[model samples]
Target: MATLAHLSDLHLGSSASAARTLEEAVAALADTELIVVTGDLTENGRTAELAAFDRITAPLADRLVVVPGNHDRCGDDVGAQLMRGVRVDVQVRGGCSIVRIDSTAPHNRVPWLSHGRMCQQVLEQVDVALGAVPDSVMTVVALHHHVVPLPAEGFWEQVSEVLHLPNHSELALGTELLKVLRSRCDLVLHGHRHVPRQFIVDGDSARPLRVFNAGSTTELGAFRTFDFAGGRLLGDPRWHQVTPEPRPSPQVWQAPVCALQLA
Candidate 1:
C-alpha cells in the first residue's frame, strides 16, 4: 500500500512557541511517501514566519505538497496573490497522480470569506489536473478547507465567528464543491477548522470516493495517514495527536469517525 502523510493549520509565527508544533509534525512524517500541507503555513504571511516554516520543512522540500491557508495570506505581495487564486501541484511518481490544490480565500478582510467563488475555479483547474491521470492511476485532491461540514461541537462555531464576522447571510462552504467532486474523483483531503474528521459522502459501503480532512497541526499537533492501492483507499485512517503532553484545549476536539471509505 502507498502511504501519504497529511497535516494542516500550521500558524507559523503566531506565538513564540508555535515552532514546536512544526518540529513535532516534521518528525512524525519521516517515512511517508509525500507530505500534504493543507494551509495556514504562516500566521500573517510575514516573510519571517514563512522563512521559519520553510527552514523547518526544508528536509521534505522535494516531497512536499503545499497549499495556502487564510492566515498565510493576511499580509502583502506574493502572499496576497496566493490567497486570491488556486494552485495545482501535481506529483507523478510510481504512476500515481497526487494533486495539491491551493484553495485559499481572497485576502480582503471585510465580511465573510474573501474568495468563496474561487472554489469553483479551483475545481475547474483540478479537472485539468485529473486529465493527466492515467486510466489506472490513483488521484488524490488536497485543499485547505472542509468541503463537507464537520461535526458541530464548537468547531464550526469558531469558524462561523471568523468567516461570518461583520456579515451573516452566506458562508463560504464547500458543499457546492463536493457536489462537483463526487462525480469525478477518488478521495478529497483538506484541513482548516483545526479538527480531525472523516466521512463517507457517497455512502459507507462505497469503495473509492472518500473525503478525508486532517485536523490542525499547529494548535492540535495532529495529522492524518492514509494507505492506498490502485487508487483505492485500502486501509483505515490513522489519526494521531503529537503534542509533548496529552492535554486538551478548547481548540482540540474529537472527530466523529476516525476513518471512512466512499464510493
Candidate 2:
C-alpha cells in the first residue's frame, strides 16, 4: 500500500496568512510518500506568485503531482508555460497510477469565467491515458474543478448562490467528464470549491468511483491523506488541520460527511 497527501487551493501570494498556513501544512507532511496538489497555486497566476510557490514547495517538488486551476490561469499564461501545455499527465509512483488533468477554462475564450470545462481533445487524452494504465494498479484522476457538485459551505459560496451567479464555481462539462472517469478511474480528486467532501459515483457495470474534494490548504487549514491497496481505498481518509499559531486548547474537528452519491 502507498500513502498520498492531498492539498489544494493554496492561493499563495494572496496574503501572509495563506503563506503561513501553507508553510505549516507542508511542515506537517514529513511522512507522506507522495504529494498531490489539485490547483490554484496562486491567486492571480502572476510571475511573482508562481515564483513564491516554487520557492516554498522546492523541497517537495520531486514527489509533487500538480495541475493548474482557474486562478492559476487568470492574468497571464505563466502557469501554462510552466506546465509546458501538457493537459493530461500520467505518472506511476509508489504502486499507484496518477492521471492529472487540466480542467481550467481556456483563458483566450473565457477570460472572466471561473467555471471550468474539459474539451473533447482533453477527454480523448484522458481516455488514452487511462487505457494505457494496467488494471492491477490503483488509478487516480486529479484535477482543479469538482466533477461532482458540493454544497455551499462558505460565506462567498452562499453569497454566490443568493445572487444566482451564472456559472459561479461550476464545472460546465462535469457530467461528461464523470461519464468518462466513473468506470475507468478508482479515485477522482479535485479542489475548486474549497470544501472538503467525499462521495461515490456508481457505474452501471463497473465498480463505484470514489471522489474526494479537498478544502483549501491555505485558507481553511485543511488537507487529507488516503491509503490505497489492490485498487481500493483502505479506510476513511484522515482529516488534518493546520493553524498559523498553536491554540491554547486543542480543537476538535470532524471530516465533512459525504453529501451526495451519484448513480
Candidate 3:
C-alpha cells in the first residue's frame, strides 16, 4: 500500500515558525508517494517566506502538491509562482486522483471576506476535473476553506468564534461543488479552521463520503497519514503531532527566493 501525507496552514513568517515540526513531518513521511499541502504556506506570502518554505520542502521536490490560501497571495505574483506546487486536480496512476481548487478570494480580511464563494466558473472547472476520474482510482479533492462549519468543542470553540467577525463558510457553493464531486471523489481534504477534523458528510447518495480538515500543521503540530491500496483508502487515517524546535535564525523573508514556475 502506498501512503500519503496531509498538511496545511503552516502560516510561516508569522508569530512562530514550525521549522522543526516541518522537518520532522518530512522525515516521518519520507516514504509517502505524495505530500499534499492544502494552503496558507506563509503567514503573509512574502517572497522570502515562500522561499524558506521551498527550502524546507525541496527535499520532497517531486512528491509535493500544494494549493494557495488567502495569505499565500498577499505578496506580488506569489500566486503565479506558488501555484505549481499547488497542482489542482489530477489522475494519480496506481494511487489516487486529486482535485484542488482555489477557495480564497483576493480580499479576505474584510468582515464579509472570510466566507468561501463557489462561483460558476470554479464549479465548472471542478466538474471537468472530477468527472474524468477512473473508477478504479480513488478520488480526492482539496480546497483552502471548509465546506462545513465543523465548530470545535470547548475552549477551542470560543477562540474560533471570536476569530470570525461573521462566519461566512462555503455553505451554498460547497453544496454545489459537492454535487459534482460526491460521486466522483471519495475524500475531500481541506484546511482553514486551523483545527483538525475527521468526519463523514452524507450527500443524497449513500456512497461513503469523507472530509478532513488538517488544521495548522505549523501551529498545532497536527497532521495525518493515509494508506492506500488498489487506489482506495485502506482504513482510518493515522494522526500525528510533533514538538517543534525554535527557528535557528531570526531573519525574515521579504524578497523573492526563486523564479516563478507555475505551470
Candidate 4:
C-alpha cells in the first residue's frame, strides 16, 4: 500500500512558532511517499514568504503537491504565477491518482475576503481530469477549501452572513462541486478552516466518497496519512503530530443517503 501524507495551512510567515512547528511536522514525514499541502503556505503571499516556504519544504520537493490558498494570494500575482496556469493537476503515484483543484476565489484588493468558489469553467475542468484516470486506481482530489459546511463553521459564518459582511465563510458553488466529485472520486482532501474534520458523502455508487480536512498543520502541529491500494482506502486515517499527546478524533458528518443537497 502507498502511504500519503496530507497537510495544510502552514502560514509560514505568520510567526516564528509556526515555522518551527512546520519543520518538526516535515521531519516526521520523512518516509511518506507523497506530501500533499492543501494550501495557506504563507501568512501573506509576499515573495520573501514564498521563498521561505520553498526553502523549508525543499527537502521534500520531489514528493510535494501544492495548491494555493486565500492567504497565499493576499498580495500580488506571485501565487498565480506559481500555479503555471494550471487549475487542475492530475498525477499518478504509488498506484493512486491524485487530482488537485485550485479553489481560491478571484483576486480582489480586500484581503479579509477569505471564502472560496469554483466556477462552471473549473468544474468542467475537474470532470475532464477525473475522466482521464482509470477505474482501477484510487482517485483523490485535493483543494484548499472545504466543500461541505462543518459544525465548527456554522456559528461564525451565520453571523457574518446575517450582518451582510463581506467575510462570507462558505465556498460558493461548493454543493455543486461536491456533487460532481462524489460521483467520480473515492476520496477528497482539503483545508481552510483550522479545524480537522471528516465526512462521508454517500450516493448510489458502490463506494461512498470520503472527505478529510487537514486543518492547520503548522499551528496544530499535526497531519494525517492514509494507506491505499487497488483503488480503495485500506483503513481509517492515522494522525501524526509533533507533540506527545494524542490528537483528538475529528467530528464525523454523514451526507444524506439519497443525495447531498445541503443549504
On TM-score, the leading prediction is 4
Q: Count the backbone clashes (under 3 Å) in each candidate.
A: 0, 0, 3, 0
- By lDDT, the candidates rank as 4, 2, 3, 1
Superposing all C-alpha atoms, what RMSD in Å does each candidate have to the true structure? 4.2, 3.4, 9.5, 3.4
- For model 1, residues 140-257, the per-residue Cα lDDT tens digits are 7777766644443364455655675422212254665555556456677776666666766555544346776676676666666777787666676775667876435534445554
Give the TM-score comparing model 3 with the true structure, all chains together: 0.79
Measured on C-alpha atoms, candidate 4 has an lDDT of: 0.77
User: What's the CA RMSD of model 2 in angstroms?
Assistant: 3.4
Task: Give residue 145's lDDT in candidate 4 (0 to 100).
Answer: 87
TM-scores for all candidates?
0.79, 0.85, 0.79, 0.87
lDDT of 1 at 32: 73
Give the alpha-carbon lDDT of every model.
0.64, 0.75, 0.68, 0.77
Any idea what lDDT model 3 has? 0.68
Position 7, candidate 1: lDDT: 82
Highest lDDT model number: 4
Model 2: worst 10 consecutive residues (lDDT sum): 246-255
Superposition TM-score, candidate 2 onto the true structure: 0.85
The whole-model C-alpha lDDT of candidate 2 against the native structure comes to 0.75
